[model samples]
Target: MNPCRPEEPPTVGVEEEYFLVHPGSRAVVPASARVVARASAALGEDVAGEFTEFQVEGRTQPCSGARELRAELCRVRTALADAARAEGLRLCASGTPVIADADADVSGDRSGDSTLTYISDHPRYRAGVLQYRSMLDDFAVCAFHAHVHLPDRETAVLTCNHLRPWLPLLVAMSANSPYHRGRDTGYAGWRAVIRSRFPCLGPPPYAASLAEHERLATAMAATEAMLDPGMPFWDVRPNPHLPTLEVRAMDVLPDVADTVALTLLIRALVATAASRAAAGDPGPRTGAELLRAAYWRAARDGWPGHGADPLTGRVLPYAVQAQKLVGHVRPALRAYGDEDEVTAFLDRLASRGPGAERQRARMAAEGRLSAVVDGLVRETCPDR
Candidate 1:
């Protein structure tokens, strides 16, 4: 049914995208090339370019435990932040930058900031710009991507198939991109909607066997509709460069600890699904159309808001879905020794709410998106 047989425990890695901004004004700035040059010189290849010149990404080596992953994230964030500061810019790690349109106009009018205009200078990125044009321009959003190693392509497909239903709940938990183009976008995670604009995005079709998976994917790839195999842009997919299943649903979290927490949950989910597969149990049978609708609900109204349960299709409070998810993954959490940390993290998140809520709270109280940016800058790097 699956391609790869059991091998060893999977490793975890994280790739986080950040906004390069003026520390004083909190405006997104197109200084990533300079910052990346400095960061790569000091921190090596883990620091790299994103879709646009206003964004930079940091990746970590495959790690075994949450503690190890946490330490690496802390180091990577510190190094990148330092690199940005050295270039007279700051790196803010959130799903979307909080720069008001007025600030962009001022910077654009003054220095030709090109905050929203400059695409990354890579060949593929340029190709994408030429091909997508306006669609590409509308997508300056960022996200936190997590990769969980699978034994081989077969297992990767299995994990991705099984993980489909969980995508919406995770999106709700990671919702952070409420503001876009300087105003509230009316969606908790606007990045999700923007990303779904790609023809090859959203949930992949279920593959009864590895042969079916390969056939479907090959056919799609042959059309050249997408940039590449990885371009499908499904919320979860087999990594193009590694033997892993990458989860891309979660928006970039403001806190490094929260990032690690979500990473742990992702790994646990994969492990749990793999075990079920081993026992000859297929995962949830949610239809692709329903999955799409559920994702839309989560993106439009994250956390505590009503969302359709992927398993039952019943509209329920997000809190109910979250609890059910935790219960479903309890065995994996226990096996991975992540139960305590995850429980605490969930409690904290529920107490304060997702980044979108926090941002709106700041806006409501201060009546200024600038203040939201100020708070984001302070919380971008873990206290060090």
Candidate 2:
């Protein structure tokens, strides 16, 4: 779409993964097939099953503004929650299940004598289980992915370099998974920690051009480190099938307002990057190691804590980084008429903390993980 001109904000879409939880026990249940079937009847292909049977995902159509996106997200999430309720389950938007059966075996004939349960009956997922084996044991984490349309693959690849320095800030702002397997992980976004176990996980490497990006993706696929060229597991990358650069660093947020806020911010970040690239500004050349360190810090600390600036490798408080991000993207946000909504969302987050902190607060107040799951289910699909 003309590569994010100042007058034209890039169209964006979001994909959110959710967990199906038993309402009483608060345990993740393998009910995605039934829940997705019912939800798809109402929401069409926008709702679908994820890699694991206990997880489902909802996708929003490309939207030009925050209001449209928020409506679409609410519609899809409501449909899913209704469907899950119909089947005696609750839809949870947390990054990880509050409680899970850790010893539960992968269900599917592809994994040998295991029963036909847990894993979704997909060829790719089956192959993944066969290949990764034990690595897939605790692989039920969910994430929020935002796709911002770019002019072309080349531009998308270039924009990724520009977007790299801010990945940690995004992680800190969107931290939602604070607990895993019924116990507090002591990290804000434990989902990030879970994802890092994969071969090509974490922040993407700097690429001089689209060709370089393709070469690395192809190599990863050839080595069987990834399921395919499309699955790099990087925090950010040029989406293989879409003409958009996707940000996959954030945990799936329970609050719809937070989701809309993050998506708009992502669009602004991409627009700002693309405009700078057009003006002959080469983006930050942050090293891979420094980026990883910064990512780890964000996952551990969330916000209002210590974080490192990937650009200069300078450790700074997350509050400072958050302010810097808002300042950097303010021009683009204003151009898109999204400054007010985004700013308000950020302020609320600063005042009340992100989903991770809220979830932790619930746990502390009720003295049970079930309370955290209940809070997640409630926030996942608030009344319209």
Candidate 3:
């Protein structure tokens, strides 16, 4: 297949995960089964269960542009929120749960042990819980994934290389998890911190070819680092079953506008990268260690904080790097007719700060984590 042309931009799809929380206490509630059933009746297959019962995922069909994507996002989110309300729970789009019943003994047999009770009954999730143990205890974190169509597996692998240098910026831009387990974790995106505990965490390794990527994935599976080659858990990767590059570096955003903005930016980034690769650009050969450091810093400080440029080893404010990313992908954005919308979103981010900063401000004003959760719930499905 030929690479995606500038005039014919690739279709994009998005998957967003959300939390079900108590209305007054804001504690995560394990009600996904009921909620998903109710929501699926309205949204059909777009609504599904996640690893834990406290979480639910909504997927959008492939969309040609930001406007269509935004409509789908709003529809699914509104449906899920209404379903949660029907189940006497509120929907939250934050990356981490603000509060949880950490000590509740859900299993009648296991006294004082609520470890595996929250996990969904799916075999895959059960296996993950048994293998990872305590790692799944507080694993209610949610993320936003954008799938950008590519010509083929080879092109998608190459595009992953092109996307490495910018992954940290995406992380910082979507930082939403400021508090976890009922208290501030002192990090911008605590969800990133929790995810770092996984064996295949951070940006994926650079692979010169599809064969090399397969070799690495096979080795990781052999080591039991992940369940299989299909589950690398990297920030970005070529989808194992789809003809698209899936970016999983971002947190689930509260606002649909932010979600649409990020999705447009990701589509532009993929288009620009694939175009460069078609023109014989091998993409930046950033070292894995440098990229790891950059990701950690981005997760720690978020935007307006110092961020390291993995390509140059130069540390700059995240806002500077964000502008540079916009400049880098300006041509593609313009080609997709997303320049104005994306620029306006960035301006709004600059003025009001990303979700993490806004969350922290709300915490300060209300002096309560529940208030922050309230704000997130309000922002999550404002249309409903």
- Candidate 1 C-alpha lDDT tens digits along 1-384: 132222234689999999988867778887888999989976798999887778999999999878999989988888899998898888786687677345343112223433335677778876665566567655677889999887566666766678888899899999998987678998998988987787667777787666776677677767754666544566777777787888988898888888888898888888778766666666677898889899899999998688988888899988888788789878777766887878877887779988889889999999988888877777788462
Q: Which 10-residue window of candidate 2 scores lowest in summed lDDT?
A: 103-112
What TM value does model 3 have?
A: 0.96
Per-residue alpha-carbon lDDT of candidate 3 for residues 217-280, written as tens digits (9 for 90 to 100) = 8898888787778667788898877788999999999989989988899988888888888777
List the candidates' TM-scores in order: 0.91, 0.95, 0.96
What TM-score does structure 1 among the candidates reach?
0.91
Model 2 lDDT tens row, 93-112: 99888898655444434455
For each candidate, how many residue pairs have backbone atoms clashing (under 3 Å)?
A: 1, 0, 0
- Tell how far residue 245 is off in model 2, in angstroms: 1.4
Model 1 off-target regions past 4 Å? 1-9, 100-117, 222-224, 382-384
Candidate 1 yields a Cα-based lDDT of 0.79
Off by over 4 Å in 3: 1-4, 104-115
Q: Assess the local accuracy of residue 193 in candidate 3 as a C-alpha lDDT between 0 and 100.
A: 85
